[model samples]
Target: MRLPIPTLALIASILSVVTAKSSTGDRVLVVLESGIEKGDYSKFWKSLEARGYSLTFKSPKDDTAELIKYGERKYDHLIMYAPGQKTFSPALSPQSILHAQLDGLNTLYLLSPSLSPLNRDTFREYDLEFTDSSAGNTLISPFSSLASDPSSPLIFPAHSPLLSSSPANPVLSPSTLSGGPIVFPEAISHFAGETPYGFPILGAPRGSYVGGSGGNSNSTAGEGRKGGEVVLAGKMAGVVSAFQTRDNVRIGFVGSGKALSDKVWEASVEDQEGVTHRTANAAFAQDLTSWVFQETGVLRVECATHWSKTGGEVEKAEYRKNEEVAYSVSITQYSPSSGTYIPLVTPPSDLQLEFTMLDPFVRTPLILNSTASSAQGSTTYSASFRAPDRHGVFKFVVEYWRPGYTYLRSSTTTAVVPLRHDEHKRFITGAYPFYGATVSVSVAFVLFCGMWLGMGEERGRKKAE
Candidate 1:
């Protein structure tokens, strides 16, 4: 008997609630400025929805815009598009949003030149410092022929020295190099501090600088201008960047909200050669969100185990010193298109496993074991080596960190106990010389005793005579 239509619809809804499109989760809360409508970012929103994300839009000051309820996060991701808004509802305060991120919410901040002080400070916490938006410090590229004025929004060539994409990074597709130039309309550039957890997705053009229309970045502005400083210039500026927390939560920073808007999505851009082409913002934005929302470059450790190769024991908590040991871990990466985790067919060449005790005693590469990876949706990595001769507590650690991928970490502790006295071998083949020497000494003693006894008996017969 087939289920009714209503029943089917209910089942679908239930499944949607339980299953997440992004590896992190699917619920997204987009906090828009008061005057801004969700329609302003319709294309961006629609793309996310197409990937099965449920978006909830609210004004910055809306009292109902609560990110957390009863100490539980109601959403898995957040989009803060209120660049000009200075005040937010209590529930959506900067502290609260940060708290939500700490609770595992991925956040995307779309900023404007008139960035609010609150937002600037919040971004500073991530080691990002934006140009003074109030001073009209928009990034300008002199090489772009598209803009009539020197200070007009800059257009950058899609690839290389002009605008570099982190293709090695999963945040942008490899096809981005062949795509059209990206347009930065009224863009606000920023300086990113050195951080291991952060990386730039799109770098500023080579000639771009934060200054007025006619000023040379290297020279001081004329008379009375004692301190005319160029905040950032050249590749020092960041157009877009991302940060990943230790927990694998992601946060993205876009210099201009308009970059992802429908206007830019449907617009065209011109390169330095005056060749006009469609904008690459749509594809770039999609790839950016795909990473920031954990749709791609997401990794999961399916299983990890260690065992004694000599004893044929699996996952034993203890092992004898100098024992031949084996370790294996299975991992998978999420595929947004299929909404499932698939095996990372080509394992990272640098992936390593460390058997450490305070310091690593054995550091070896985790070679892909195709035969052991017969299970679906995971790739198994294995390594075999002898345990350290010294007996002590040690941990098997796997730390895999790349720019765009989720940081994978797995640690298992085990003890290496000394062999028991009874566990020692009774005889050894390598001591043949000592064994022969003992036999020779025993024969010599027996012969000496027989001669002494014979001599004593002969003396006794003489005394009787």
Candidate 2:
């Protein structure tokens, strides 16, 4: 007998739910303020769901709030939407969270002015800071596409990436429908040699300000927050920033709690001309989350090796000054579509190799390796150069850093020495004059000695007679 339409529909729905539940990808932990029911933010959760994330939500005060289990992280990422949360479970202390990131836990965060000490410490460990609101915790800008009052919540026309280093900005239509700047000029210590990687990727328009007054006013704005003076806004300020650890773990932050809130996320606006367009919040959410979860701009160094140029074979520390040598490295990056870190066969032109002792002795481009020079079909970058004529401990150093991509660093040291006595050439073309002069002097001395001895013997014979 054929199944009824209702029964078939029910079965299909059950299967779809099971499939979603069983999906395998980055496991996400979401901490939110209580009293805000989960269903209220269905759109935001669904946005992440469409990106292959398995989400788990909890209150900071959840009795069983846990992140790590037995030295292993239980979740791959954290989304904190609770700005006023007074406390967090002990497992989320700065030290534990820092360690989790060291072991690779990406994060997405939004902070409020009422920062708890625990949350503050967490941000500090990652070399990041949220902008302070001097006027009030909230921002109201005169440059509005939505509200007419300058002191009311402002809507920004998001265009152009914060920096050329940022990924290309998404295209928007209707021209007048713009994006809003999330409050705060967050500062990120993006330079290397600090805690994980951190930098700004999105920016707010100039002249935006913090509204409301009579609270803590000791906060300084960060990079990209400019325009409104008196401390809250400056010349240039960033609204969104990102970071990543050496382990390829990542973190993203948006200053406004409502940046993706249900109310403003679906922005539809009309002007006097009656044309309508959506705001950039949706595009920004996709881009930011993808980056936070390692879906965008992720790279890895698989392995590196160096070998003597004579036979192209690798062994322990053995090299000679002025000898030819070759160096190669394999690289790959995350491909969201394939769900793998695929080989980066064609890298940028600036990719290079540094043969260094103290300063660089050889700096040259690393080109794609020939199939014979590398593992067959490997995505390897290779280069060859003669070792410096001088001898000391040298290294095969590859440091490839570019904007919007993970930094790549690899250094391998090798011992180098002058040629051995036997290995020295009997004659050098460039030293022919010196060798000729020395040989000529030696032969003349021997001839002079022979002449002197003969003269002495003749003189003695004459005196005896």
Candidate 3:
């Protein structure tokens, strides 16, 4: 009797699963507070689990709440689901989040529908402000599908490559949307103060104000009245705000949690051409996750320059033909975690150098000479080559471009020319025949003049006699 295909598939699947688990170690730690609804995250958690991550959930009330634990050590990620308590202490405060980040842990924090009494001093320390105001409200634009159906409790604006399609634009045409969720705050503001590392993720619709009673108020009110109107009648808007601290810690502020609801997570938006589609919250969530996970591309050096050791104090503006010179270059890489710059190296080695003019004259692989104090960590390329005999404005150039690394470009020009006034050989062996001919002519003339004088004297004596 032949075995059933289902049984055979099940065995194969189990074997594959075992093999995957043995090779991969991925885990997540979710910290949810009391009373917050677990909406689309449930689906997301399942997806993560399916991707071979072990998901663990905890609350601030748990005995181990203060401790972030993983398989052998601590969690690789921390998901904060809006704590309702008054204050998150140092052990549970935002500093804890920073600590986790310092340890290379990724974090995601969601905004709560209701404001918690917790004083976000830590966030304030980073120049972020969260507030509650009656003046804050969402607006539906004629451009959005939500505007067409005011009664639709769950409305998705449009599909965005940067965001999932379920949540579409409510004001601009869905086609104009690039990111997910235009978060309009009833009243919210973030001031960067001395440091402006915080980048705005969304802005208010055109002609929107942040304060006031949200009614018709002219601009020419009394001084006190104007101030009051500005404070109380202006509109507030922000979809998501993010900041990177001097220490390289990133924090994102979300104004509305309803946008990430379970139903919205499953909703998708179709492109205008109808060629592509994306879920509203899914795309946004994916992008946000990628950013928080530090997977986004960071800074890279595009280029650099270096001078030669013997290029003189002025750095040799030009080079002459047959002149020998040396040059070096340095390229670097950017690290988002430490927010520091690091030097780049060749594959089998740490650094490389080149000597070039128009085309590379010398392509030499450099080896780090730690024994040499001048080149301890640096790779030096040194060589002596005569400039091409051709006379022209030629440059000594080194151009280096590495993937995910800074680019290096360096050049020095030396004007090479045919032998100069003092450069030519004083006497030419090939002109010996011409030199001898000229000398012989001068001697013959001198001899002829002397003989003519003697002949004159002799003729005078004969006349006297």
Which structure among the candidates has the greatest lDDT? 1
TM values, all candidates: 0.86, 0.73, 0.47
Best of the candidates, TM-score: 1
By lDDT, the candidates rank as 1, 2, 3
lDDT of 3 by residue, 89-150 (tens): 45556666666666555556665525464634555665655544343323222122232321
For residue 120, give model 2's deviation from the true position in Å.
Answer: 3.8
Residue-level lDDT of model 1, residues 367-429, one tens digit each, is: 988887776558999998899999999999999988878899999999999989999878788
Runs off by more than 4 Å, candidate 2: 1-25, 148-162, 166-196, 211-229, 271-275, 312-317, 368-379, 431-465
Q: Tell me the number of clashing residue pairs for each predicted model.
A: 0, 12, 36
**Candidate 1: 10-residue stretch with minimal lDDT:** 218-227
lDDT of 2 at 263: 57
lDDT of 2 by residue, 271-380 (tens): 22444545556656666676677666667778898888786586547688888888878877666655566666345656899999999999999987657334533468
After superposition on all CA atoms, how large is the RMSD of candidate 3?
12.9
Clashes of 1: 0
Give, for candidate 3, the lowest lDDT window spanning 10 residues.
147-156
Candidate lDDT values, in order: 0.79, 0.62, 0.46
Instruction: Show model 3 residue runs off by greater than 4 Å.
Output: 1-27, 47-54, 67-73, 117-119, 134-145, 148-194, 207-236, 266-279, 299-465
